[model samples]
Target: MDVDYELIRTREVRSQKKINFPDKVQRNVSFEHRAHGESVEWHYEENEGVAVISNDRLSDERYVHIKRANVMDDGVNIRPPNDLIEDLSRPIYKGMTTVYLAHEDMLEGDIRSVYLLTESQAFTLIGERTDDSKELREVLSNTPRFLPIPE
Candidate 1:
């Protein structure tokens, strides 16, 4: 079966906020959210590179919450932590001008997907996955930009 993949370009505005942890709990983590709508917000942990969607007005009862950790090492000399490479072999975007679209239901949960992405697309997906995380942004900024390979 051929599957349709959608390019995820994050359009949300992100901002940092102070989190009040429980009085006895000791943790060092920065918090932020990319607002999707009035009832949905995308939150991420900067240090851990994990993100989740919090939807307050969800009407569906069968919906499950899933957390995703974006590839932190940029797949250069490093590989995705654990087995993500086997799971998400397809890059979200392929080439400079390539784009893919699919219904939200077509993509979900922990699963392997197929797509190849251009360098720019990789950057965009990385930005979305990390919620525009500060550390990764710094790493990406310091890295040199390259032209996408022609197909």
Candidate 2:
């Protein structure tokens, strides 16, 4: 059976840091996507003072680092950083899925490769230097309810 997914809700959570960076604040924004028989929660944390930006999927406890970049003079060029790829693939095994998350600018014939994430797992590669308008919309629309949300 074909399952249809939809974004159901979004929530923002904020908290004050008590340890090393007492003056800094951390923010977590969550998005919930649901399908006919399943749902997934995805969220990202932002801490500007420490330059920490990451995403996590509440389901499988998988998390990844988001590296942001700005538009260059030439154009909106995007490629997953080698370090991130290495880190994500460190636990490489058979049937592992790699999903390339790119800014909209990088989607127009700029993507070098495409990998499918299984219904049970997935990861995101965010481009910090470019605008994510297209990528954001596409992700919300195409992401399945079973893929792990970035934490």
Candidate 3:
């Protein structure tokens, strides 16, 4: 499907509190809803190149409430430049939002770890959501013979 992938920023916070632990965290914001119609999640990401969402996607009764930000020790070393997926696209704004709707659910996780984001640290992830959304409707309007989009 023709999915309009976008990242939307609803709010931004410069945390006054800091946490020191296994890893360092910059900023954190909590969302009210779950990803796949169930389960809550906590997104753990770095201020640099590494972002990891730590949450339990297994249970329907649990929802993640991002308590606060954390400060941690220095992380692992870098990888070869060639091994990295270089995003040469435009400069993503700090509070800019993108929406991608689809006929079927695209994002499997309620929480996503965004890497190499030079701007905002935390924001809402909107894409291939409901069946009747604009994203899904637009994709259904066309047909592709080439095959599914490349990874």
Candidate 4:
């Protein structure tokens, strides 16, 4: 079956709040949902990237991992640069019963982009660097403004 997935909306994930957590607990980045969709699928292109979506805000230790790729049963995917992918996967902290989306891709891995959907807000992580939180925040704050408010 062929599914024509349309670009319903797109928003640059940015942290609106800060979280204080111990080093052991993996704290993911946070962002607000400027747009909403019931069955929305997120698409991104990177080298064997894995996106982890969690509802930890509602339930502790609950997450869904998605491999961001370009090819799927349904033909829908966007080829984002490695730099961009890494930028999108920064760690954020906030509380809003939101959904979290995180991604990680190795330097020498297969190049596949994929997408996933959720019911609430989510955080994202990419690459394997744990010391780039500051850089990620700067990148998000500067370029690529948020998607315009929908009518």
Candidate 5:
């Protein structure tokens, strides 16, 4: 059986995920993506939370240090950054998947090094693309916990 779904390019993908929290309390969720002698620090802040996610991986000029701010309580909406949509060739990852949440757009790239960040852990969906429909059907049949994103 062939799987039919809407696959949007990374640049055009918009996330339905949102962050809501109290303004007075400082909530910091920090994670490090260190590899190939490059240590990249990622943080989830209040107002800047959405900005960080959309900007970090997609920007041409990487941020050396993302400034953390505490501001009035407001809901932060997440979406793919403008730069990413304009340029589909930006390098977010090479052959391997990073620790960050895998946006659905990653699947549309030439290198389908897609990683899905779940509640408890992360899953890699690399090297799943193939020209042979028979082989592709076999792989998808046995795959676990895979779900299509709703538009």
Candidate 6:
């Protein structure tokens, strides 16, 4: 599936989903192109090497969406993306799913190779690639260094 994730702010979502997640938290917002009425946002928490699904959401206008998945040692407790669940316990796996990030080599993009980033970095190579350098660093500065995903 070709998902063109748009980085929107809480304000932009006002006319869209209407739900307000904490700002500065990076999210891979998903929307159905054909069906313009429905939308879902996958809120994730980036741990060291793992991106935890803090919440799997659905729009009031739309229903057929995979709820959030939880990552646990023995087994996952949350709902899995229908396509992703091989009837197993893996919570978050974007197999074949594309991540739109400019910095495909950074710890964030390294979590998933097919990432989405800035237009400039999309074509260029190397060094501090993110949606916006100033904005990204600002976000990172506030994010706690719990478990930084290693390179």
| Candidate with the greatest lDDT versus the true structure | 6
What Cα-based lDDT does every candidate model obtain?
A: 0.27, 0.25, 0.26, 0.25, 0.28, 0.29
Output the better candidate (2/6) by lDDT. 6
- 1-151, model 1: which lDDT tens digit per residue? 2222233432221122112121111111111224421122223222223322332212223222233322212211111222322233232221223222122232342221212233345555545434344544444444333111122
Ordered from best to worst TM-score, the candidate numbers read 3, 2, 6, 5, 1, 4
The prediction achieving the highest TM-score against the true structure is 3
TM-score of 6: 0.21
Across 29-129, the per-residue lDDT of candidate 3 in tens digits comes to 12233333212233222222222222233222222223222222232111112212132122323233222122222233453322222222221122224
Candidate 4 local lDDT, 117-140, one digit each (tens): 121212222212223455543432
Q: Taking the tens digit of each residue's C-alpha lDDT, what string does model 6 give over 44-137?
A: 2222221222223423231223343332222211122444233222232322221233222222321221122123322232233465745654
The RMSD (Cα, Å) of candidate 1 is 17.1
Candidate 2 structure quality by residue, lDDT tens digits, 79-143? 23334334432322333332223222211231111121211223232212223444544554454
Model 1 alpha-carbon drift over 4 Å, by segment: 11-13, 17-37, 41-50, 54-151
TM-score of every model versus the real structure: 0.20, 0.23, 0.23, 0.18, 0.21, 0.21
Report the C-alpha displacement of residue 14, candidate 2, in angstroms.
Answer: 40
Q: How many clashes (backbone atoms < 3 Å, residues ≥3 apart in a chain or on different chains) does model 2 have? A: 13
Q: How big is the positional error of residue 91 in model 2, measured in Å on the Cα after superposition? A: 12
Q: What is the lDDT of residue 73 in candidate 6?
A: 22
Clashes (N, CA, C under 3 Å) per candidate: 7, 13, 12, 22, 0, 12
Q: What is the lDDT of residue 127 in candidate 4?
A: 19
lDDT of 5 at 146: 33
Q: In model 2, what lDDT does residue 10 have?
A: 13
> In the order shown, what is each candidate's alpha-carbon RMSD?
17.1, 17.6, 13.6, 18.0, 15.5, 15.7
44-70: candidate 5 lDDT, tens digit per residue: 222211223321233224222243222
In model 5, state the lDDT of residue 139.
57
